[model samples]
Every structure is written in structure tokens, then in C-alpha cells.
Target: MLPDGMTRRDLGWAITGILGVFFAAMISMNVVVTALPVIVSELHGTQIQYSWVVTATLLANASSTPVWGKLADMMSKKTLFQVANVIFFLSSLTAGFAPNMETLIGARFVQGIGLGGLTALAMAILASIVSPRERGRYAGYFGACLATATALGPLVGGITVDTLGWRWCFFVGVPLSLMALVLVGFTLRVPVLEVRGRIDYLGALVLVLTSGALLIWLSFAGTPEFFDWISWESAVLLALAMVLLVFFVMIERRVSNPIIQLRMLVSRTTLLAALSSASIAVCLFGMPAFLGQYFQIGRGLSPTESGMMILPLVLGNLIGTMTTGRLITRYGRWKPYIVVGSLILTCGMFGLATVDSGTPFWFVLTVLVVVGLGFGAQMQNLMLAVQNTVQVTRVGQASALIAFFRVFGGASGTAILGSVMAMQVVGVSVAEVNGTAPSATYADASGTMFLVAACLTLPAVVLNLLIKEVPLRTTI
Candidate 1:
């Protein structure tokens, strides 16, 4: 049986609120991209710190996703969703007034907490209302929302930064967040899975510690001066993280109401979907960090121009996501779209690897569109796969797990790729490039990063192949 009053429903205005929640979160993330370099320069933040601005938010998002999902399972999804939005709303306002890198990063961390809830709860609600077979069409709308937000984010950031300075980018999303809250607050209705037990506080502690330690390592490893990958600091942190992970596992095994269910995790469908998400994440997170820099620095474009230049990526993403989502729903199969997405992603990455500052703008745009297309197609399916494999009661945690892996992978990719860019920039400075060395350095670095990123997709494809497609359930 389903929760009372929320069964056999098709999306209505509630879809507006759901998409609004996602759009608000995406706007906040995207709006900051073009403003990042300016924010760093204005704040006198180090390159490491500049990279941390994005990575910090992602880490926080990853860490909090499961907690938020678990809370939705134990409590009211609608209330939890609103709470997350309020956190984002307040934090965005605070972020606009931030005087330094520390304050901005802190605000982003809080914003990420809200974003995590939106991400997890949005999917849970989708799964709760829409059947797996019909979910793809609706999921396509979700993907379109993401693509639209991403497409417009750079434009919004650029226009705001150019007109009102960088701070307004942070502030602009506030009204949208408020709108989402009001819409969802009044319209959203869903049944909560009633479970009796205390929240696994100890599991949360160990999980955070474990995730924190690993993220710290990812944030700093192999960068210019932070910590060497083979250094004692690395060893100590990794060791501690591993031990805590072990402890977290043990704690979950014994907990009466575990936040994460190991049995659910071990299932082939869920496991493979998670693995696929990690690679897709590398693409998703790596793009904003690298391509954002490329347009601004490498291509010698203004923020507005860069934003416009990146629109094709969003277009590609929209096509891929919506096309796959629609096709999957209509045909009642998912594997074909996923495989095609993987191929397209790898092809795009390889094409991007060949690009330099002098490469034709059209070529670059086409390649990015390819990447976006692949990501659009692959991303939601990963979540759908997990949702399909689990029961309704498992929806919240299962959805959270998929999001957690994607964000965690994104955090790792962003940090690692950011470090690579910084290291190459340092290398360029040491060798003395002739003209506009910083931009040249960024160009040289990004080409290689794209090639490396292509390698990341192969494993995800392998995992996707292992995902056995169970027939999608027709009812919620």
C-alpha cells in the first residue's frame, strides 16, 4: 500500500514546484560559474581556494544527501524539502555579502545542504508518483530543467556580474527559491513511509568522518603545495577514512533503522547505476570548472561571451536527456539510450581533447554539445535504474545513494581536474610563456584534462553493461 492521499497521480502544477526546486538549485550553482574568477580575484583567494569554492559546495552536497533522504523517509518529504530550500535561501543572501573566500565557501556549504535535499527528494517524489515506465517522459522534463538551468546559468552569471558586479549573481536566485518554496509548500502532497526507530546518529558520524577525510584528500592531493598523493598526510588521511568506512559499515549492520541499507546497495541494478553515475559526474562537474575557465581565459572571451559560447553544451544536454527520457518511456527500455550516451560522451571528450585556443569555435561548440547530449541521456537513467530496482520504501535512500555517488564523484573530479589545471598553469609560469601566459596555460591544461576525462567514461560504460534491466513497474 502507498501513503494515504498520494497514490495514482499524474504530474500537475506540482510538477512546476518540483522543476522549480531543481531550477533554483541549478541556477545557484550555474550563476556562480562565470563569477568565480572575479570572486577569487576580488577576495585575493589562492588558486587552491578558488577551486575549493566549487569543490566545497559539492563535498557538502555529497555528505548531506543521504541524511536528507533518510529524513524524508522518516518524516515528511514536503516539509524536509522546504527546510532545505530555506537553508539555501538564507545562505544565498549571506553569500552575496561575503567579504572573503571563507565566508563565500561557508555559504555555499550551507546552500549545498539545501540542494542535496532538493536533489534527493525531487527524485524520491518522482519515483513515488510516476511509474518506472512513464517516469522517463517526466524525467525528461527534469533533465530539460537541468539543461535549461545550465544553459542559462552562465548567461545569468555573466549579465549580473557585468551589470551589478559578481555579488548579484548570488542574490538573483533568492526570488526563485522563494517562489519554489511557496509553490511546493501549498501544493505538494506525498505519503511518508512510516518507520519506527531512532535515526542512526552514530552511522551519520562515521559516514561524515569517512566522507570528510576522503574529500579532504581529494581536495588537496597532488596540487602544487597542499599535499603530495604519496605523502604521510595522504597516508594518514586515507587510513583514517578507510577505518571509518569500515566502522560505518559495522554500525549500519547493527543499527535498528540504518540510514543506508547495505542489502539495497549490494543489488546489481543499484550498484551498477551508482557506478555509472560516478563517471557521468566526472563529466558534469568537470565541465563547469574547466570549460568555464577555457572560455573566459583560454578563448579570451568576456563572461557574457563565454556564457553564450557554452549554450550549445546545454542544448546538447537537453537533446540527449529529453530524447532518451522520451524514448525510454515510449519504448519501455533503457539500455540502448545509455549505451549510445556513453559512446557519444567518449566521442565528444576525444574531440575536445584535440581543441586548443586556436581551434575553430564551431568545432568546440559541437564537441561540448556532444558531451552535454551524452550527459543528458545518461544521467537521469542512472537514477531511474536505481529507483526501478527498489521498492517504494527504499526509494528515498536509494535515490539519495545515486545522488550521493554523483556528487561525490563530481567533487572528486572537480578537485582533481582543478589541481591538474593549476599544476599546468604553474608549469607554464615556470617556463615563461610568451603572451597572456595565464590564458595560454589554461588552454594547454584543459586539452589534456578532456582527454583524461574521456578515460573516466569507459569504466562507467562497463558498469552500465553490467546493469541488468528488470522490467519497469507500471504502477507507483
Candidate 2:
């Protein structure tokens, strides 16, 4: 039932407002993908900085996600959402005018903090107002918006970079965010209840430290100037990360309101879905980060052309998610879709693993379609399954925990895969110098990156297989 005094029209407007925020956030997250090459070159950045530019944002988003989720369970969701939007707007504007790569990255990190809140809170608010059974259709709408923003990101970013310059890529989201903020202020209405729960400040700190240490280790592991994978630096960093993780676990167990609720993992479904979400993210986030380099640098395509080439993936994502979402709601069957999606995703990753600069455009487009379809079908539905297991009161925590895993995995995987590609490029360069290879290109290294992604994704298929399908709950 609708809350007292709430009408369906109110709900529709609220959803529109929510989607606007989501659309703007997604655009900010993805607009840099195609433009990173130009951005790095103009700022005189190295390969490591190229990856960190993306990694920094993912790390910030992942680290802050649980806290945002926890807060939604305690505070006014509407107020928190606006606060996040404002943060995103201000940070995006700062990033647009940044004169150096370091400043851009710092701004991106702050931007990520806002993205984290918007991401976790959107689902929490939806759960507060809609039942899981009905949520599937709305989730489909969310997925469509996501696919659209994701689709437009590369194209718009390419055009912006090609014509107006790279700075405009960041500026484009400012107005969109402002529009969302205004719409949400006028339309979004949820009861502010008198909930009492302490924020887990200590746990949040330990979690950030742990994730930061691990990412640092991954990003610089084999870079000769920094340290080797097996050197003393790696050992110290890894040990520190592990110790912090242990502390984080201990803190969570004792805290009144832990950032991540350990109790949720005890559920078999939640555990598997979390694992699968993390695994799937390695490909979902990693592919776009590298594909621009593959098309532009390796294959000698312009940013505009690369953006046009990526259309198949986004189109497939739109088709897959929209189709499966409605099907799940209609037939009340979700597990089969997830399992099948996992298989398709795995196959696509393996197929991409074989691609090189010389690969035919048609073959690349076909594989991208498969990959997009797999991701679209799997991403939101996993959250839907987890949200089904929790009551409305705890939905924020449950939903955010799953999002944490997804972003965490994406950050880690991006760091590792980016390092792998960087190292591969170095090796190929050396081989070219010694006359052992004819060329050194990101196209060659990209195959190795996708191979690693495929290996990581292999586990998700098994994890999803073990998830027990539960009937969708009918009431809030």
C-alpha cells in the first residue's frame, strides 16, 4: 500500500526524480572512459596515472558505499540524496577546470563519494516505497536509464573531447545534476522516521584503509620504479591490508551499527549473490576502461569513431536487461535468468580474450553484444534477489552491502587488469626493441587483460549456480 497521503502520481514523479539523479551520476562515472587518453596526454601523465584516474574514483565510491547505505537506514533519505547531489555538482565543476591530472584525480575521488551515496540510497528509497514483486518493473526502468546514460557517455564524451575539449566531458554532468537536484527537491517525499542508530565511524575508517592499501599494492605491484610483485614493499603493503581487514571484521562484529553487517553473509543466497556480483563487476567496469584504449590507441581510431563502435555493447545491454527484467516480473522466475546470463557473460569474456588489433570489427561487435547482454541481465537482478530477503527497514543495508562488493571488485579488478596491460605493453616494447616482435600496442595487451577478466569471471558462474531462488516477496 502507498504511504498515507501518497498518490501514484506522486510515486511516478518521485521515480522520475530518482532516475534523473541516477542518469546524471552514471554519465559522470562513464564520460571519462573515451576521453581519458586525451586527458592524460594533455596533462603529461604516465600509464599508472591513467589507471589511477579511474581507480581513485572506484576506490572512493566503494569505501564510502556502506556508510551511505547505513545512513539511509537511520536518516532522512530525501535530505541525504540532495546532499549527495550537491557534492557531485560542486566536485564535477571543479574537475572540469582542473589544470593537472593530479587535481583531476582528486576531484574525481570526491565526485565518487557523492556517486556512492546516490547509488546506495536510490535502491533504499525504492524499497521503502515498493514491494520486491513490483520493484522488478521499476528496476527495469532503472536499468533502461542506466543503459541509456552508459550508451550516451562514450558518444557524448567523444564529441565533447573532439570538439570542445576534454574539460567539457566533466562539465556536461553539472547541468544534469542541477536539474536532478531541483526535480528531486520538488517531487521526492518519504517519511522521516525517528530511527536511532549510531554511524560506524571506526569501521568505515578501517575499511577505507584496507581497500586503499590493497589497491595501492595492485596498481604498483610490478612497476619497476616502485616495486616488484614479490618485493619487500609488496609484502609490507599486503600484510598491512590484511591486518586492517581483520580489524575491520572485528569492528563490524562489535559495532552497534556496522557499515557492513556480517550477519547478512550468513544467508546462503546473500553470500552467493555478493560473490557473483563482485565477479561480474570485473568485466562490467573493466571492459569500458580499456576498450577506449584498444580502439583509439591500438587500432588507430579517433575518439569519435571509437565511441560509435561501442554502440553494439550498450544496445545489447539495453535489450538484455529490459527484456529479462519484465520476464522475471511476469513469470516470477529470476534464477534461471541469472544462471543463463552468467553463462553468456563467461562465454563473451572468453571470446574477447582472443581479440587483438587485427580482429575484425564485426567479430568485436558481436562479442561486445554478448558481453553487454550478460551484464544487463545480471547486475540489477542480483540486487533484487538480495532485497527480496530483507524487510523494508533493513533493505538499505542489504542493498548497499551488495553494491559494496560490486564496487570493491571493480576497483580491485581494474587495478590488477590495468597493471597487467601496462606490464604487457612494456614487455611488448622490449620485444620490439630486440626485433622479436613487429609492434607494441595496447591492442596486444588488451587480449591479456580480457584473459584475466575471463579467469576472474569463471568463478561467478559457479557462484551463481549455488544461489537458491526465493519467491519474490509481495508486500513491503
Report, for every candidate in turn, its global Cα lDDT versus the true structure. Answer: 0.82, 0.86
**Residue-level lDDT tens digits of model 2 in 1-476:** 77666788888888888898799898887788889888887787777888888899899999999988888888888899899899889999999999998999999999999999998999888888888888899889988888888888888888888899989998887777888787778777776654686788999999999999999999999976578999999999999999999999999999888888899999999999999999998766667868877887777777777788888888888998899889988988899888889999999989999988789989999999999898888999999999999877788889889989999899889999978977887643321222122233777888888999988888888998999999998897
**What TM-score does model 2 achieve against the real structure?**
0.96
| Residue 343 displacement in candidate 2 (angstroms) | 0.4
Candidate 1 Cα misplacement greater than 4 A, ranges: 1-11, 427-438
Q: Runs in model 2 with CA error above 4 Å?
A: 427-440
**Pairs of residues clashing in candidate 1:** 317-372
- Give the alpha carbon lDDT tens digit for every residue of 1-476 in model 1: 33355433424767788798789888888878877767776787766787788887888888889888788788878888889888988988999999988999998888888888888999988787778898889899999999999988888888888889999988877887888888777666777677778999889877777877887887678887787889999999999999999999999999888878888877988888887898879877667756777877776777787788889989999999988888888888998788778878888888988877778899999888888988888999889878888888879999999999999888888877777776767644321221233466677677887777778777876787777887778887
Q: Any residue pairs clashing in model 2, and if so which?
A: none
